[model samples]
Target: MTDLKRLGLHDLHLSLGGKMVPFAGYEMPVQYAAGVMKEHLHTRAAAGLFDVSHMGQVILRPKGDMASLCAAFEAMMPVDVAGLAQGRQRYGLFTNETGGILDDLMFANRGDHLFVVVNAACKEADVAHMQAHLSAVAEVQPVTDRALLALQGPLAEAALSGLVPQVAVMRFMDVAVVDTVFGALWISRSGYTGEDGFEISVPDGGALGLAQALLARDGVMPIGLGARDSLRLEAGLCLYGHDIDTGTSPVEAGLNWAIQKVRRTGGARAGSFPGDARILAELADGPERQRVALRPDGRAPMREGTAIFAPDGTPVGSVTSGGFGPSVEAPIAMGYVATAYATPGTPLEAEVRGKRLPLTVSTLPFHPTTYKR
Candidate 1:
């Protein structure tokens, strides 16, 4: 096998009994000796530290003014970039001409510039896309000197505040640069898990130290990819290549809320983005299919790629993300199905293995979110 890239906390991960696995071109921990189940439950009850350095960090500085930069960015996607207030972060997507999503991302307006985080597998292409499109109005700089860490769960604030008391005042989606002994931490009070947490970007030199310190705190344990996947799946958040991709439109993926009113038809800045015609049309009308939450009938989890069928055995959709939610203690899944069958409590069948299993369309986030809004 070819060598895989390693995170800055590679050694620390091994020392913590992390079982490393290849993921998104990196040798990341799938779970520690505590196992995926314990880690998942711990994260929901207390805090779990995750090493996510494989994801990309980028800085976009305006060549002219912040307004120009935001305008240039808004052209690439249907999001209202210019309206994002300072010190706050918002979820965004990059779309192709057909309104299919290229990649989903998070961008924070950090005063004069924008700080963005993209999926690990799409970072290179995302950065290139930004450079090719926004080069005339903004300087797109990829950050390579920082390692990102996510401290997640209910006790996340207490664990993080132990080191930096300033974090205690931050609300959900709040971003700030706080001085720490390790370095200046660029932190955001956000996470993919349906829990209160923070994502911290620390310089490479201080990554291991900060991770170690966080682990040293009571109720904080090292979490890995296995639990991370389950956590996000339970949260009903779409996984880029799986639940969403270049073939999926935001509206079909249940992400219309991410597309603000200003970008919709009849709004002030409507229809300039790629695929705005189809996207806006879908908004006005409705998508042929829609992403929905699923509750499997039995203990078995209907994993990704599992085909969904109507009660009459007609093919309807396919499962994108699925697994047993530790907190919910039940099998949960998210997938796209015919719009008519996407209603909550609607009966559906998933072909797991060969036999069809019963399932129901349920409300999103099988587990409720506890974001500190």
Candidate 2:
């Protein structure tokens, strides 16, 4: 049996009758006693709190020059790191030599330090890669003592206003150092779900108390991995290992906006990252395959690993993530397919349980996002 690692909120989850499951090496709650459907509806109607402490949090500081550190980091990602303003965060991908994604990460400029959040499963490899390539002028420190909590939904602000009033004013992608009843922490107006929310990074010891305080509110409920997956899928957000991997580039993942034009144009920092040639080529001519959203005709959920077929019934790709979106009232999925069949409104079929279900290519974020900004 594999030893399951527990987060700071493990006891809280168990107390709430959480259905624990092993995920990304952690014993995480897949759903609460209220069930996935109730948790999903709660998040959409009000707020759902998630314990994301299993994710890796790292702090990067420049040994001497911040600009040089930014440049060094930019060489590994396609995002415009140098242009990131203080207290702002951007989603980025760490690409390998062939333009394949190592992991998708969030980079937040915290004035004197840079805060990086990576996938729980890929954290070790990501940190090693950073340490191996970062110049002597930069120091990479892992913040294992911290815990991350995401409070997502329309009522997120209302739930948090009593604790941190400034969080209500912060726009999407904005970060603020707030002095809460617990202690000093970094609260970012962001989340995985396509809703207004905040990601709080706090001292590990204080996480449980904070989570309890949040859940004590009227609109807040404890959510789990199952609902988190469903919410991100409904929002059209990519899951690190599923929607993208070492074999997929940002271009093919429908994440071209993450790459800046200045980085594409050769200059001081242009074409410095690994697989720049292939990435630039794809940027110009488009990728052979592209990630797309799909809507199945029936109520049955199309799950990951389900085969996608062309009009002739030949395999083209496979579903990466799928489920019934409570907010959308239909089954939604995301997958990679040949570029020719990736257009919106293209007719396709997903083979589920030896049965081909009629499907069609559709625009992502199956539901409209309600971001504060």
Candidate 3:
């Protein structure tokens, strides 16, 4: 097997009892001694810190300024890049010519330039794609030496205020640069766990120190990827390559809100991106199959790739990501099924061991989001 990369906080994770495992070509912590269940609950009740350095962070700068940069960048994707205001972040996707997703990402407007965060698994391909199409107009630079950390949960604001007091005044999706003893940390009021939190980008040399400082604070604990997955699942967020992929469209994934009015069918920047024809068509007419949340009444958690069937044994769809939600207190999953069967309270079955288990489709965000906005 090929060697795995270590995150900047790898040693800190070990010292804090993270059970390390390989994920996204990195040696990541799957869980700590408290385990996935407890960690999941603690994050809900208090603050939890996560080392998400494996994810990609990049900066896009134009030859001149932000005016034409947004237009040029907008030509490459379906989002309203020009509409993204200063210090604000928006979720976007790189769409292929045929309406498939290249990768889903979050981009923030930083006054002078754009800051982008993408999945670790797709960062290389994503950067290559940008370089191929955007090289002539803008500089696509990767921030390879920084480390990203997520401080999430209800208590996240209070816990973080001690270090960066001004962050408490910021709303969700707000980005800023805060100076600390270590260095100027690029901090954002955002996170993946359906809570009001921050994703802090610290210098590589100070990642361990920042992580250790946060861990020493009350109500803050080191959470691993295991809890992170379950939290996002509960938040009804998609995990690239699992809940969504190159085969999926933004419409099929129920991400219509991510597409703004300015870029839709008849608007000014309409039909500018790769798959606007199909995406707009899907917007007018719903997709054949749509991603839905499933609630299995039993305790056993069904995993990804589990087949779904109707009560009469006709197969409907399959599970993409499934697990026991420590907060939901039941087995929950997100998957695609026939549009007709993708309604709340609609009954379906999932084949677990040999027999089929019963389930019902439910609305997303199994847990409510508590963003400060």
Q: Give the clashing pairs for model 3.
A: none
> TM-score for all predictions?
0.99, 0.97, 0.98
The local distance difference test score of each candidate is 0.95, 0.90, 0.91
Candidate 3 lDDT, tens digit per residue, 69-121?
78878887888999889999989899999888999998999999999999999
Tens-digit lDDT track of model 2 for 117-219: 9999999999999998784757889898888999999999999886778887899999888877677778999999998999999987677778888999879
Residue 130 of candidate 2: its Cα lDDT?
92
lDDT of 1 by residue, 1-373 (tens): 2689988888999999999999999999999999999999999999999999999999999999999999999999999999999999999999999999999999999999999999999999999999999999999999999999999998899999999999999999999999898899999999988899999999999888899889988899999999999999988999999999999999999999999999998889998999999999999999999999999988899999999999998999999999899999999999999999999999999998789999999998888999999
The per-residue C-alpha lDDT of model 2 at residue 237 equals 95
Minimum summed lDDT over a 10-residue window in model 3 is located at: 1-10
Better of 1 and 3 by lDDT: 1
The most accurate candidate by TM-score is 1
